[model samples]
Target: MRGIYVFSDLSLHERLQKALAELNLQQPTEVQQQAIPKALDGRDLLISAETGSGKTAAYLLPSLHRFLATDAPKSGTRGLVLLPTRELARQVFKQFKQLSAFTHLQAGLITGGDDFKYQRSIFRKNPELIIATPGRMLEHIKRNSCDLSDLEVLVLDEADRMLDLGFAEDVLAIAENCRAERQTLLLSATLKTKGLMQVVDRVLRDPEELILSGARDQHGNICQQIVLADDRTHKERLLYRLLEKEQYNKVIVFTNTKAQAERLGGAIRYRRHRAGVLQGDMTQDERNKVMDWMRRGNINILVATDVAARGLDISGVDLVINFDMARSGDEHVHRVGRTGRAGESGLAVSLISASEWNLMASIERYLRLQFERRVVPGLEGKYKGPAKLKSSGKAAGIGKRTKGRGDKRRGESEAGAKKPKQRLRDQKSIGKRRKPSGNKPAGDQAGSGALGDGLAPFTKRR
Candidate 1:
């Protein structure tokens, strides 16, 4: 009976069943059916599933069952769910509280953009569930507040996004404080990186792995399109033209940086469109208010960065506009995945400039779907010259501007981009040495005849 997944045969408490029925949840989703059983059985899990695949319920249902099934004599904090952004933490907290409305369970969200005093008071209640972001949670930990030793389940929702936001170290630090035998569940939209794999290895013990395919590449209901923009100005014009089509309602416009997000939001607002900016630099209160406005339909357009936009479960968003090319192909997927949520029909439009051509190609290749590339009626021109792609992780040929160390002003340094190598005591103690070069090594002629590796040459290794 252990580790077996059977939603049909599974029994839930009458109260929970009633709550589910009230919410119109008649049947378990494919992911829920498969994941809930193992989670309920107190097994660590690593799930690579798609966005909007009902992952929240998959983990929440089992967590609820565990809470209600076991006695909670003292609930200082029974479950800890770490998400990458404040929006996701709020969303998860809301969902869990919704399901636990008729039960004795209590849940709290610990995130930035809120009052710490209020959060402390909420945490003092010893909630059955605590949903948080790693950065804010770590702050709480450092203050000698919020005990996690009593945590029974530790869920890292959107695990890949957490790493992208540079929360890996904070996540590990917090996780180390949690009980060693606790049921740890890692849920991600994708997990191909070695860092993510290493995290899974460290956190999960004999985990039951589940890879729900098909959800990754095919969001059947969403129609994706790529539009060609001659330049930044042309892209803006095309965006305005698209918004003029009344059919596109509740649209979200994504940008790669905070400055662009603010500018776009300002332009839209100036045009009498209900628009707002959502970025990490905004205070928690400001971000919350903006999200509330969007949810309340007071704002028609949300211009945001990846940090602000990811993990948002806002309903009725019918259009997603990528103003700038996404840095990674996976990020492209996450951006489009926002609109086509909860089984809704949606449209995703990408504006690709000549420089972003390579990024566009990579996205198409990843999805295995070639979009029809077309230009707006008024905007048509050939690229004047080949624009050098930036040398960062961003694919070359996506833009004409290359931001390199050479581009920096006289006083500025490229320190932020250059990460120092992390030294590990164990690896050093192992005394492993890289094989020395037998000779002067292969020349450019022997390789590809031109600095030959496909990737840009890095600074010479010390």
Candidate 2:
């Protein structure tokens, strides 16, 4: 399947083949070869493949072929692709347009930050396909602006990331609105993605489960490494050195927070590197511009957060630096997958400080891979690594985590500060302030006359 089947062998529409030729895509990837056949057969598919695999094309090609071959009227969106982020939706939309270049099938893009009226107009035109995020699509559905009754195919790309973004209910609502008779395809990077099976149970019907590549499957072409940094400043210096010394055409540095990404991007630019920042805070247009600049090689360095970079694929990104370690193995997989794409060689170096050592180790254990420890010649940190390690590669705690140890070191300790009394016993006067009724009428007892020490009757909510 790897090399035996090309796009021609899959019996795609001739025009589509022409477009593929123009894109120089002759041979089908493993995921594409396996999925295109089953998808063409109109089977519900649950595909678990590695990131940067040809999953997008695997689903898109079969869908476009079905649309192009059939002479049915385009009543509404015949195919719908639901992605986790606006970046992904844009990427898929770009690819769809490229593949359908030779045909008349139209695709609409819907996401959080676009014009609602324009999207409604897109629906009015009844395009053959719509690429959208779950949240915005649900908004359109609520407005009766989204048409799915004529939908023939449904795809959930990055299913796990959607669940992480808390789109489970929105997706279910959208699925409920779609015709159950339509074909469904769900793709995720990991099989053990939390709440992924629950979504599968409800959306897919007797689906053909395809595990072309699992999350644990290491990227053979990526050399993963770890650099110990004392702090963010240290990490920044290390990044500058990497950009100076490494042999990479393009590099991306991932941070955990949007603010960190912006700050890092600024620092990199201050070092005279053409860097760009991508995060949720930016408007869709800004983010799109940054991505455009990246693709055209106007900017070679991209500083981004995990959510913003989801499903992003750019060629020549040979180096990935985790300015901050990914919080989970699934995140780390996607972060590293940005490089070493399409069987190309890559280098992914994660900067791990003492606080992130265990998290990095946990990710290593989860992925069943070890990151090589590297050090800068003059910028090495004092905290080299752990003194003891668990069999799973996590840092072994000596005994107990000293209370306030971290806060103390960071000048945030509460030690020596007077403990403000917060217990009820510390305010016993609350009960003593009330007077006894002494068998008086209820109204009279609650009056001011019943107060002890002539205090007002605990009125005005104390």
Candidate 3:
């Protein structure tokens, strides 16, 4: 019933209502229903929702609502949103502009890889809301180009991701600099991350916890499948085949390394398809060009690293191919979630090599789901599913333990394998001690090169 709630029926001001009308945002998502009312109540909130769950609107609507209020003259930026990546920061800034389309309020973008002088000018303009990444925002804070003393509301988007990028201290320090009376909203897709809760405890003040969707439930509609491959060439063939065969308006292929993304980009381009590569090493201008191409449908395929996986909300990404599957289940969820978004059907396919089969199983176990085994007609790989499975249903890794290590270890452990190592010379009996030839007196043996301790006589090494 809550999912059926519409945006116009909610308490949003007419300005926002009109903007929502233009954005075609009529029905409130599950997250929006639960988060907006609490956010409007000026309550600090801790939310755990999937990516592309309308969580951005949930918080942005409330923050915009605050800006639309006619209560007090704005002192500084009344609202601040901190994200992990520049792309996500830009995405949120775009949405902020779209949502405030009907209002006179302004939102500024503060991120790295842009002209610092221009950002300082943006600070001088004193936008009502500032969307920034922690590092560059901290830089502005250090320069006094940015101030949060009069901040009214603060939102930390993808908080866990910020922590993962080693920004724990930076985020904490930024939160510390915000106005003490600010309403803080901390949102993260994966809540079980190590330092995420610590951040929640430190930043949010008695926040109401909002868990709208579990990680397992996030990608339920997306069809997940695994294609077995032998090696890199095999994978490339399979990928090229999929690109030709799969019917998709747009597709993103995720790889673990920038090098792989580059390689795949070239490979796809050679197949006569327009492809773009998005990674961390590229200049922001290059990245912007790629994303612009992506948005304009100039590029049908985009190869990217995990940098794009976290908080990006790209539309028409009907298919996701794991050229390289993610290292963790949380990351897999984010990758797959890029598709099948906003109640649209999508597909995610991962190419499993001999090396990646075990990782695939681990992710399956972690997510508590199974992947459909798919074989391409001419490009099927040698690496099918594993021959053995653990009692927990994960593929048994071909580890030392599985390779007769258990029995060998049992034999060794029974034979006192834990004992300290002994050199062969020390282990062998060279002869009896002979008591240092005490038959000869000590004084007589001293000149004979016997040890002063009288344990053994020195012999020349052959």
Candidate 4:
């Protein structure tokens, strides 16, 4: 009720109230209400929710409130938030700065790209809040440039993704350095595997567990469609055709790799379309410019990798085209979720190749829904390529076709009759029945001596 603005008539901190009121944030998102209270109470939290559900504000508000509630002390690193990527750390730092504008909270950002000497100089000032990447933070700790002895709160944003990127060991090492009494908050879009739980135990106390349900479905307002692209050629053809015709004010194309993003951006630009690329390989200034162009509608088509796509708050992005399907089903959900946000109707188009059939299927399964498949009219053609799973092996009720020479044996009994009727049994017994395992002639094998070699010599002709 403290955070809920819709049903309950409750007030918040002056700054949060003013910002929420100004932004027309009429009510607390489910994640905020469920997690903020405990977070404010100084309990460790494990939260599993979807992106764009106001999860950032949920934790930020409570952390800021706790900072303000206490007496103002000399600034020191009291809170540390570890994000998976530099981009995400930057984005989260931005949000924290915006929300804490009224409060004199000094938040510093530590990531890989910036100058280390500059960062070390800022550390001398003792920032109260430090938002950083695991690798960079570890560097500071090793250099004895930063101290975690007074650190009270540790938040791991995008924990699942950090694990996916092979940062589990780094995360554990960082966790070991934090204060033993720290209130650890683990937040992720989706949580899987007990290994994640094991990490939780290593850092957190009994801690409060909050799983918000109302945030599960992000694509509710987005129209999703699957285009059947049997191969890469077909996929490209369909993508080209759609871009030529689809009416969208702004578009974001997602690719699996940085190189793919660059290539796709090049092709779109070669066609005279305003396009740009955003990936991790780009320098900070270059990435900022691309993001600015995208945000300003100066670039109508922006091709980006998943890192740039996560925690993205782009508005008016009316279309999202997945040029290269996501490697994981979870990533697929997050990719299309870029559009159709904030209750705005948008379109998501996936150019799925045969090799990606199972990836698409797994996505469908995760969303617990089926998508309508359509083919571009002029590009329909039979494609010959390597076999791909029709869907993930778990696609329900859609049986795979029998392959090799195993098809014939499926319905036949050991006797080789289509059906095991009594008449067939009597006939089989009278003449010949193939012995389960013997190389003798058919007549001798079935115990019928009259029919000499009975079709055995002819059967052996092959």
Best by lDDT: 2
Candidates, ranked, TM-score: 3, 2, 1, 4
Candidate 1 per-residue lDDT over residues 191-271, each given as its tens digit: 774489888888888899888853346477888887877799988988898888638669989999999999999999888
Tens-digit per-residue lDDT, 1-462, candidate 4: 324345133335776666666666677777777887788778889898777778888788877777777744864688899988877787788888778877788889999889999999878888888999888889998898898888888999888778877788889998888888778899977767337877887878887777664223557778888786776666767877888899998888888888878887888888888999998799977887887888888888888999866778777888999888777667876787778765688898887666666677777777777766666788875743224334444324455776755755764555475764567556664666676654557657676644464543433334
| TM-score to true structure, per model | 0.79, 0.85, 0.85, 0.79
Question: How many Å off is the CA of 163 in candidate 4?
Answer: 0.9
When summed lDDT is taken over every stretch of 10 residues in candidate 1, the lowest stretch is 384-393
Question: Candidate 2 lDDT, tens digit per residue, 190-281?
Answer: 87978899999999999999998888894878999999998878888888888888888999999999999888889889989999999889
Better of 2 and 4 by lDDT: 2
Please identify which of the two predictions, 3 or 4, would achieve the higher TM-score against the true structure.
3
* Clash pairs detected, candidate 3: none
- Report lDDT per candidate: 0.81, 0.89, 0.88, 0.77
Stretches off by above 4 angstroms in model 3 are 1-3, 395-462
For each of the candidates, the C-alpha root-mean-square deviation to the true structure, in angstroms, is 22.6, 14.2, 9.6, 13.3
How far in Å is the alpha carbon of 208 misplaced in model 3? 0.2
TM-score of 2: 0.85
Cα RMSD of predicted structure 2: 14.2
Off by over 4 Å in 4: 1-11, 22-24, 214-218, 383-462
